[model samples]
Target: MNSQKCYALLIEKPKTFEESERYCETIGGTLVSFSSENEFKILKGRHSKKKFWIGLKQVNEDWEWMDTTAIVYSQWKERNVTRDVFKDQKCMFVSGTGDWHRENCEKKLYFLCKFNRMRLT
Candidate 1:
């Protein structure tokens, strides 16, 4: 009954961010990628305005989404001035429609993963 985008990446039940990331791998994908505005919109909200996970990370104080998709545009949320605020805090989650959430590399949450149907041979 949640009003969020349904994704095949996340397990049916809610899982931690670490668990979700690993789960995505099992399905031959990663915790989703949203480099385009359209893909970002697909994961706009939850029923109660909670944040979900995306496949991004911080390294050497730079914030980036999963390497799967090239970043077409960036619409950093108003409260996201803390990107790379921590040294080892890698991996990312995005919610709040256009904003991003960064957590520890091991933080857990339901994630949106994606995979190409076929290998690019």
Candidate 2:
């Protein structure tokens, strides 16, 4: 089994969500998805005070990862109030403090991408 882990790449340049997604794909990766608080913390520890795009988006009133994987975890801020305001805000981004927030997908921002490490075998 390929037990290699995945790692993230923080592209400092600002780009719209669609552009960012394409960029990651060109490099053999997809936008970063956080499945646990630990993964979020590690990302937070690496980046400084900057907003970065993640892999979460609202589709038909449901939140889903860009890769179409089940959303097993979330770190959304103002969770209770977000549902009401999320109608116009479909794309998700991570704040400096590691909390998640919704934004327009057209807004350009730094983005995070995840690629699996290849086994050296």
Candidate 3:
């Protein structure tokens, strides 16, 4: 649990959703997800009313979290998993309320990045 300070990164640029996701991975965070009320509050308070890019991707038009590497858990802005317009898209974002939404992976948006405990490997 002793991880280095993980700063929430805000990326406001026009890039593919995949690109955004990859950018966070490169830095250490994997897009922001509201898994708990506290986390939701923290991110919400920190970001206020801005939307940011996340690391969720749509495979075969289905939404999934790239961080979890599984489908059992969902951490997104929207409850509905299917997006007609975003089906082909492969990136997600965090709305002001800490909800997830599918948008153009290449669209410009503020982003939230997370830094986890450095791996011991």
Candidate 4:
């Protein structure tokens, strides 16, 4: 049997980043956060072929998880860096191809939430 403690739930319904965060709280979990490159890769592979939001988001000029953890690992896809400095909030998500992408918080998309198995079970 698997001995891991963390687990993920992929909410298939599309919702804005804020809405998704609230929903995860309702379920007693938070949007997924990665602790390492291997964890990110494994989770991304497990949920391949679909775009989904993770817990990472841009705060001013730095990206951080919803729980305020500094990002120690990342696998970002190459994209244009141009942005309107005053426009909207930027959120990050895992692409179907398993790389991180930054998007506006107002955009609707599926999201993954993480919960501790010890508390859940």
Number of the top lDDT candidate: 2
Q: What are the per-residue Cα lDDT tens digits for candidate 1 across 13-108?
A: 667667777777777777766656765565554322445677666546666555445656565553654534544556566654546645676665
Ranked candidates (TM-score, high to low) = 2, 4, 3, 1
Tens-place lDDT digits, model 3, residues 1-121: 1134355665556455666677888876777544556555665676677877766677675666676644443456566656465465566676776666777666778777777766577
Q: C-alpha displacement of 97 in model 3, angstroms?
A: 4.4
Q: After superposition, how far is residue 90 of candidate 1 from its true place, in Å?
A: 2.8
Each candidate: RMSD to true structure?
5.8, 2.6, 4.0, 3.1
How well does model 4 score by local distance difference test? 0.77
Q: Each model's TM-score, in the order given?
A: 0.64, 0.86, 0.67, 0.82
Which one wins by TM-score: 2 or 3?
A: 2
Which pairs clash (backbone N, Cα, C closer than 3 Å) in model 4?
none
Please report, in order, the local distance difference test score of every candidate based on alpha carbons.
0.59, 0.80, 0.63, 0.77
Best by TM-score: 2
Off by over 4 Å in 3: 1-5, 12-14, 69-79, 83-86, 118-121
Ranking by lDDT: 2, 4, 3, 1
